[model samples]
Target: MSANTPMLITFVIYIAAMVLIGLFAYLRTRNFSDYILGGRSLGSFVTALSAGASDMSGWLLMGLPGAIYLSGLSESWIAIGLIAGAWLNWLFVAGRLRVQTEHNGNALTLPDYFTTRFEDNSRILRVFSALVILVFFTIYCASGIVAGARLFESTFGMSYETALWAGAAATIAYTFVGGFLAVSWTDTVQATLMIFALILTPIVVMLATGGVDTTFLAIEANDPTNFDMLKGASFVGVISLLAWGLGYFGQPHILARFMAADSVKSIPAARRISMTWMILCLGGAVAVGFFGIAYFSANPDVAGAVSENPERVFIELAKLLFNPWIAGVLLSAILAAVMSTLSCQLLVCSSALTEDFYKAFLRKGASQRELVWVGRGMVLLISVIAIIVARDPESKVLGLVSYAWAGFGAAFGPVVIFSLVWKGMTRNGALAGMLVGAVTVVLWKQYVGLGLYEIIPGFIFASLAILIFSKIGSGPTAGMLERFDAAEKEYQDAHL
Candidate 1:
């Protein structure tokens, strides 16, 4: 039998289980609301894990570990920034967004919330926000695709072209049929598998290296800078790394988790559960990369695959150090990571086309069944577009993710903050912030010589534009103020 048979069976079984979940969710889905947002019915456990799973993506397993493997501990500044940013987002934005979106005409998506929040009569803000989501999210989805492609190429020994479509097929099938509930439910299972793999792999590596002390000694022997967090890091570069948290505010997929919670009351518990899971998972990822440094240094003969692609450190290690049956389970965690994020991103893109464009313009009176079908069709459309974007075989998972992450963080972060908190914020202010944030990231990424991450500059410029524009633009209308005030009170009460 081929050595790849066990892993192949694992992949087939996992994919089959997830598709079964989609079929199960499809039976429960009744309308457009159920299709896109799960009818706002997720509990705290589901919400927490689904949010964390969708947020982490294959970036957590492949991209993050790869960076640490290549660069050492200095790269972990990004992890620190992400943890702080995610905590703040949960504390401040999650519950408030839940209450506010519900109050604002039960808005199913961010564009819908923004339209009602500022009373944008011209629907200009709605159209613009939806467009921004499509653009950045398409890029974001491409990152997931690239990560998936890498996994398949490395594991199944498939050609890059074949892996691209093959890797995407299962995620597309589940998401196309079942929508948010399937994504969320499957996320919960995937999150469990991811944590199990992350925790187990690092511990096994540590034991193989003798212990923590011996592991560090091996790492130090390979490169002393691996232990030095500040090595070659400037103040600006560090700030840029830390700014990853800023993107959480504007992430439509994570925000949808907030929106789909059964009630605002669930946010506190969910935040606690989610944060604990995130910290552990991130720590484990860093350990896998850092510890692999020691493991590979000792066993250089078996390190060929990992040396060729640092991102394969986890994959190579899992296959090398564990029994084939066990390695298959661990490897499935990586697939889970890819599918969880890609599935949600596809659904969000589908929501944008179906809710923000098709229903908003072409068919205001479209029936619920028709809208659900439209959402499924949009999922297929976006998947094809993202596949096209991901056609480049040389794409780096972290590089692509950072670019798309910056675009969303800059474009929508400040606008979300101001709209939710500042009573004085105007529709024009939101417009200004979104446009400036997005454009700055694109321009800075393409032309700027600065070594800093684009998110810091993009976020700063976007905040300034919102402040300046809001000052010059009109204040919130009475109804807007009333809704905002009422949502705030309800949010506070839920927390208290």
Candidate 2:
């Protein structure tokens, strides 16, 4: 048999299983809510793993490792920042979002929450927030597609376009059929595959380099600077890397995991589980890249795949170190990462269009059955757009991820923070904050040459905008305040 046969078989099996899960979820999806948000019935295990799975995406396997492989330990600063940011997001945002989303008209989408949170009868908040989701998520989805394309191209020796569509096919299949429930459940399975691959790959790499001690020696021989976290660091560069954590607040896909939890009471357990998985997986990714330096340095003749594109470090290493059967499973982990995040993103985009745009304006009295079909249609629509965006074979996963991450973080992070905590936050305040945050990120990214990441300025400006606008504009109405108070009370009650 050809060397690629086992890998091909493994890939086919994984995709088939995901589609079967989607079929199962489809049978249980009785309404639009279940289709989009799993009817808010996810348990702690599903919620925790799904959130982590969706948040990490293909970047965990491809982009972050690549960055570390290219620049050494300094790149690990991004991982540290993510740990801090994810912890804070879980502690402050998860439970509150779960409860607040429920209390305020049982909001199934962020746009739905915003509309009811401040009682925005004009529906401006719903329209704008949905637009923001669609815009940034399209770019975000493209990053996942790019990562998938790279995987297929490297493994099967296919062209970029062929790999792109081939990689996207299964994801679209399961996601289109099953919706949120399928995405979440499949994410749980995918999360397990991802962690296993990350942990085992690094160990194999360490062994291939002789041993831990020998690996370090080889790394030192290659360039001792690889061990220094501050080897070529700048203040702005470090801060920019860390700022990735902030994006967690505004991530529609990750936040969906929080909202779909069975109850706010599930949050503490879920948070604990999520952080543990995240830290281990992140540590493993760092190890893979760091140790890969030694392996590649020692075997420069076989380093062409990774040398050409650092993102393929993990893929190249897996193929080289493991037997064909084991390598197939390891490679499937990359697909797991890609599918988990891409499915959630597609579902979120569909929700924004179906629940926020279609139902809100186009068909206020549409049947639940009709809405589910509409959501599925929107999923196809967004995937095509994302595919177009990802057509450029030169696109880098990390670069694409960073831009969309900044856009969402700067635009929605402050707004989510202020809205949940402060009853005083008015609709105009949210509008202003979203505008300032998004605009600041875009302007800073395009025009500013400063060493700072755009999220820093965008977040700062957005927070100020919320405070200033809330003070100047009329405060939230009596009904909005009552809902906020009730949600807060419920949150305190849950903890107690």
Candidate 3:
């Protein structure tokens, strides 16, 4: 009956679908393992889509495009970095992690894997790594909430608080109920929606702007520097952009998908599928931002052109280019991207709290049912904290995501790499690496004042710490070395 009715209806249906999937997944969950990792039953398709959806977040649709729109070719470097990082992560880390995690005491979380992988009976590895996941993931989840708030605020003309809750509600509801299976299944659907919206919106925008030639000319005419790949880009700045890929190794959520795949053998197919999807989706998102520059240059009065938030470019394009009904579906894709990643982050946080902290220390004898409910409760607690952190209406999604990404990349990247590949790496080496990496990121961000991204320095320092500590301290035990060798051998045999 009204102008906003169609959009409201579309959102209701989308949210409902997410909830129903959660309910279905809830029914299938039988134990703590099932709740945390879907009992490692994920097939190739679900594993691929879920991993891509979780890794990309709304950053792919909004932040990347916004960067492209605001700057130019310089912004594309982040995407290039991520693509390379993700591929390498799949190639080296995915299968090895899958096999080794299962082999090394069936580790259900990264922290758990570390303690077992290093044969650390002190449990310091688990505790410290869990703390890292909790701290960084909260910031990561808050970034998603901020993205959602912006979307709802623009779509409904609502207050930021209302939009914040509205943006987070579906994600919280689904993850709170369904756990890992629900998150993975819904991610598949959301990933498909995301791909369609990315493909469709770019096509419509290109058509509206009259084609590639016209758009390029408009971009050059509006600002000639936008075309130069190295424009205003320094060595440090370029390196910083490329270093974003390093974060992939340490990302708990993405690695969780690899750990959940039905078998190590399935990873090759999942890797192929995910990489293809990532390149296409990433390219489309960049096109939206590049074209937005041209489209808005020609028509300055368009809603998003002068908006305070440049991230609104994708949504504004959907609204201007499509009818109300189609626009509603298109806009929901933004919500899809937001919810898919948010749910995964929340679920991972839940696992860290329940599996690492509660079961490991607070209640070692806790029943499976009790741990599952405790995890569900943690989802609620963490979501509330994220909402509070995201309350700042002026916050930029890309800025928040960047800080969290660097934090994880620096903190866990070196440790994860060394632990998997270096048999001589000792437990103390792992501890030293994690501490140096995380501390370096924080201190570098605060005192260094350098133009460099924190991750570069953090990663280097962490890697060096691991190597130096391993050499000075007692190396890994014979058993640990043997397991490492077996895992690598199995990986090679599977591929061959």
- TM-scores of the candidates are 0.98, 0.98, 0.96
lDDT of 3: 0.89
lDDT of prediction 1: 0.92
Per-residue lDDT tens digits for candidate 3, residues 66-146, read 889899877899889999999999998999899899889899999999999999999999999999888888888898898
Q: Clashes in candidate 2: how many?
A: 0
Q: lDDT at 41 for candidate 2? A: 94
Report the alpha-carbon TM-score of model 3 versus the true structure: 0.96
True-structure lDDT of candidate 2: 0.92
Alpha carbon lDDT of each predicted model:
0.92, 0.92, 0.89
Q: Is candidate 2 or candidate 3 better by TM-score?
A: 2
Give the total clashing residue pairs for model 1: 0
**Candidate 1 to native Cα RMSD, angstroms:** 1.5
lDDT of 1 by residue, 1-496 (tens): 6879999898889999999999999998999999989999999999999999999988789889999999999999999999999999999899989999999999999999999998988999889999989877887888788889889988999998899998899999999999999999999999999999999999999999999899999999999999999989999989888988888988999999999999999889999999999999999999999999999999999989888989899998899889888999999999999999999999999999999999999999999999999999999999998898899855553355667888888888899888888888888889999999999998998899398888889999999999999888567789988999999999888767
